[model samples]
Target: MSKSNRNLFFSLYWLFFLVGISTVLVGQVLPILARRFSISDSESGYFFIAHFAGSLSGIFLYNYQAQKSNFIRTILLGICASATGILLLNADSQVICTIGFFLNGICAGANIPAVNMLVAKLSSLRVSSSLQVLNFFWGVGAISSQPFFHALSSDGSVLLPTVLLAGAYLIAFVFIYSHRLEEKTEESSRVNRASFWTVWRNPIAWITALFNFAHVGLESGIGGWLTTYSERFAKEGLISATPVFFVFFVLGRAIAPAIIDFFDDNSFIFLSLLVLLVGLVVIVFSSSYVGLICGAGICGIGTSAIFPANMARFAKIFYPDASKHATPIFVMGSFGGAITTYSIGYLSDYFNSLKVGIFVLFANTLILIALQMLVLLGLQFPKKDKT
Candidate 1:
């Protein structure tokens, strides 16, 4: 890459990093927020759903608008939306927080695709690797948010994190806008009008979506509930338990990309599912904080690489023009996380056992493994090639 290209790539990479960190801030704070607001576990899960709903909306909206505008403009809009959402969150009212989360999700939904698309456009043939690099930054963000939130430990400390998150988005907006790249108008418009539906109609797209759905569902579902699960065993109260979840969650995300580079996507995913099953079992049955922390860490490591690898596979199978179509599938997979998060919340509420709700996650992981097997069988189980 040229100097300018490399700069743009890193800029976009860090943009994704900031967004990933900001998104997990809620996960870090959820337990405390639950107590502060006196909400049920299920109700706390709604915060995630609200964010997911906004993200889902942003995917379609950005897709529609991308056809009419430049990438820079689309990203700017996304940043503005995210910044506004963070400001709303600073109000510290539950209703406002919910609304803010939704808006932030929308901003994130649009921003992610736009940034990935931008990266894809800039990268050489190794688009998968490029995307993985972007995800590494995402892991950094996810991991970094833990200490960031933990540092704000005081009365009304929540406002500090929200303010910092807002500042990150604001900085991202300025960086993206200031470093505008020029593109051929005709080429940009041509890509925007490509048949996203045709790509969606592919059988592989469905398989990818299904796997992604399961992958994201399990990852986010467990992540959303991890703090609460920790609280069940902790003596330091909910606030302290929150960081334990963050530690494992971010560690897994941060480590996944490098590992995926070494393993085939199919095998990586299959192995991840198996690890997740074991972790869930350990989490549910264990009595001590040590067991819980170990389980959460294992779960994080197992689930971390699934998304990037699945996405890379989707990109390879559906390529040349897979991005426009595949991007929506990716976003929809994220929406699946929202669905599972909500489902687990409801199940936890109904059964009065977050442990039972966790079993639902284990089941989803198994379903994903089964689906991947079927897909591989259909492909005649291609021999693994060393990258």
Candidate 2:
């Protein structure tokens, strides 16, 4: 990469880190807020939906305004919104906090696709490596949040950490805006007329979307509720279980990049799904907390590479003109994560068992595995012989 491109890539990487930290902070704080507000577990999940709704709105808004302007501007706007959201979270008013979180989610949703597109443009030849590096920083950010939140803890209020997250987003905004790339009209118009549904109509896109849906559903469902599962299995309170969950999740995400280089993307995904299956079974049947923790770690390891691997695979499979297609795939995947994470909470309420809700994640994993197999089989079949 040229010096300019290298700088751009690293800058975006830091932005990814900031976003990751923000996400983890939100995840950690939501449950605390739930307890404070005296809401049910399922109700707590609505906070995630509120966040997703914001993100969905941001996507559409960006799609409209971004065509006539530069994406960097959109990213900066997102950062500002996210920062405001984080700060609002510290307010005493519950209504303000909810609105803040909604804005934060929207900002985050818009920022991610714009950043990913920037990275794609910068490192056209090594998209996978670039994305993996970005994701690695994201893991680092999540890891940092655990200790940061721990240090910020005080007399029953999560305000300090929320302030810290707001500061982080502000820093991200500065970096992104300062290094903003000049927009090229050629690239901007490349897919200006293409609708999201237009991209979704491709057979490969649908297959990948479904695979992403299951992949994200399984991953987010587990991550969102893993602490609750830990509380049940370890008999600890929410705060105590979270650090363990964060450690496991961070370790798995951190290791994914190195591991991907060694295995074919499809093979890596297939193996990960299989590992997830075993881990889920272990969690289901395990007799003690230790067993459950072990299972959770295994599941994390299994899921660690799914996002990056599938993302890279999708870029390759749909390449030569992937930007139009890849953006929607990512959007759909994000939507899937939101849906699955929220669904798990609702299902947990219905079943009255966090364990059962988690087991349902295993079934989603099975569906992912099946879809991937079909893709693999399709690849294996010989091309039709023309007379």
- Computed on alpha carbons, the lDDT of every model, listed in order, comes to 0.71, 0.69
Over 309-380, each residue of candidate 2 has an lDDT whose tens digit, in order, gives 676666665554454445455456668767877777788899887766666686787789898898777754
Candidate 2 Cα lDDT to native: 0.69
By summed lDDT, the worst window of 10 consecutive residues in model 2 runs over 378-387
Candidate 1 lDDT tens digits, 20-117: 77666566777667867889978988899988888887787767655543566767777777877877765658999898888888777787777776
- C-alpha TM-score for every candidate: 0.88, 0.87
- Best candidate per lDDT, number? 1
Candidate 2 runs further than 4 Å off: 65-69, 185-201, 237-259, 380-387
Worst window of 10 by summed lDDT in candidate 1? 378-387
- Candidate 1 has what TM-score? 0.88
